[model samples]
Target: MAIFVHYLSILLISAVIFLLLRAYRLRRLRLPPGNLGLPFVGETLQLISAYKTENPEPFIDERAKRHGSVFTTHVFGEPTVFSADPETNRFILQNEGKLFECSYPGSISNLLGKHSLLLMKGNLHKRMHSLTMSFANSSIIKDQLLVDIDRLIRLNLDSWTDRILLMEAAKKVKRNNKSLVGLGPSRLSSESKMALLITFELAVKQLMSFDPGEWSESLRKQYVLVIEGFFTVPLPLFSATYRRAIKARREVAEALSKIVKERREEYEKGERKNDMLGALLGGEWEEDQLSNEQIVDFMVALLVAGYETTSTIMTLAVKFLTQTPLALAQLKVSCWKMSGTDFKGKNHRTVVKLLDDVIDTSLPW
Candidate 1:
């Protein structure tokens, strides 16, 4: 018993010394003050919880109070510095290329592709941005896109009967409508709502010149997988989300490569479509057109950008119109004016203004 106790005492002394040495070494590194939670996950859950709250500002405020304007914390598997200082943010932005390169978490970078606009840097970023803007220029938007947007909006608005948002309702269960919650009889079934959103997604997909055919369904499924895996803890190989995302990304890349090849062949044969993809390829090769990978990334960016947000916006707009009869009446008046010759003056500027007002009113934020 005496021998065992002696060995245990030695082991405890060694552990204490090791911990002290580690603490001293860490202090020497001058890392800012804050907790670096568990391995892998770090403070991700806390960060997520902060944003999920009704009043999220308190999360940052509480942290700032505890650990000055700038502090270090492990978040999303990275040792990140959270700064509430204005100067630090401005300095970082101004020194983006020289001092620091813009970056995101591994999950985002891996999912968005290395060549994506969000991931690109220096001249590559400039070229991609310029290319995208050229395709989405004022002329294209005014002549082609505005008409598509108007037509799509009108169609969606016309086919609106059941107007309860299932996800939102689930968050705050105040109703027992079986149909609205996908339980019983309803005008707009859950499947139909999904189909409608898919149709809207295809309308947005047209901005990239992808025909709303078989590929649309495949792309939509992949999109859901990618988005689901985007911000999740990336265990790579071991994680289901990570694996799904990787598979989806590969499938997306393959599909896009096939489309690119077909489009290129079409362009070569003198059959140029009037979509963004067509615009990108139709122009003469000035400084070398985008590669298949780059094109795919651009299309993914645009499709992801427009898909859910537009669907949610339209859904909320319909909901707001139903709840607020006065707003609905005003919107009806605007729509009536928009369809008349009087609103057609000044290149339909009046109609556009009224529509914008109605949209602004409908949107919560």
Candidate 2:
């Protein structure tokens, strides 16, 4: 009975949409030139169905072939355009003006917090981007961050750790290195390390809600819960979980407030530091213009985005090298051959440059 009602509701809505689309103001949409009609179920089934077979590359290739380098279509009830051309990508990324604006589906915005630079628009987006680039840019990364990565590799191997699950072992090594580099010499225990892993898991689940993937029916059904209430919904059985996390962060708040107060004092005495929180609370942002909630939202967004790509790259290096034993051995030897001073010295970029060359030459992609 419910299934019958679902189909009936869909047909009714589609008819109404089709009629409205043919109305004078929306007449052009009735003749919209793009992918052919997908019917009441829309393109959701086609997308998820394609993912069921492990590889969706062929489907994407077919669409690209039919549509050329840049073309448009409808998916998940929205108009989507695809571009595989480098020039088109460069244009979208590099040439930004009033004409083009970035936006995501309303569903996604409801999940991720507000003011995230990834989801920001126009002037607000530009502001957050400049503020974040202060910390993310390579030029500002500490020399110790690079060296500690090498030390982390050695320490992980030295732990005697019996032949471990390669995935878990890889994560352990990557976690130590990322934390040290990102947090400026913060010491963390094994448990703290696992917290980072859990955070990434939650974040990936957040990204996957509308990511067009095939999973068990169970996972797909859970998407509704995950996407709708990431911030607002508190887990009932989890025992005041969100509240506790909020309470715990007050300590971090006091610390930030102290730092902000000190920075003001220092400015009165003529001094400055370029730390992320400092730059955010910098005079240009105007203390009154920034709310505490906004600061926390920005910090949480940074922490989530910062760790994901770093861990993925670290895992990529391990996974790629493992498949090519000779390359793995070469990397180990090369890393050792570069004495500790290599990065700080004239050949500072040499290690990353060599890795880039290795990635270009060796990656199966």
Which candidate has the highest lDDT of all? 1
59-86 in candidate 2: lDDT tens per residue? 5677778768775555544556767779
Q: Which run of 10 residues does model 1 get worst, by summed lDDT? A: 176-185
The TM-score of predicted model 2 comes to 0.55
| lDDT per residue (tens digit) for residues 1-365 in model 1 | 99999999999898778657755865797988976665557677677666544455776787889998888776766767888999998998998888988788877778888777787777877866786677666564545555555555455545554764544533232132121211112344443355345554555456556544566767777877776666556767557877898889889888877888898888889988767778667674435877878778877776666555665554555555556778778878867756734323365576577668767866663
Candidate 2 Cα deviation (angstroms), residue 62: 4.9
Each model's lDDT: 0.65, 0.50
In model 1, pairs of residues that clash are: none
- Off by more than 4 A, model 2: 1-41, 49-53, 61-73, 83-99, 137-140, 147-160, 165-275, 286-289, 304-308, 322-327, 338-364
lDDT of 2: 0.50
How does residue 240 of candidate 2 score in lDDT? 47
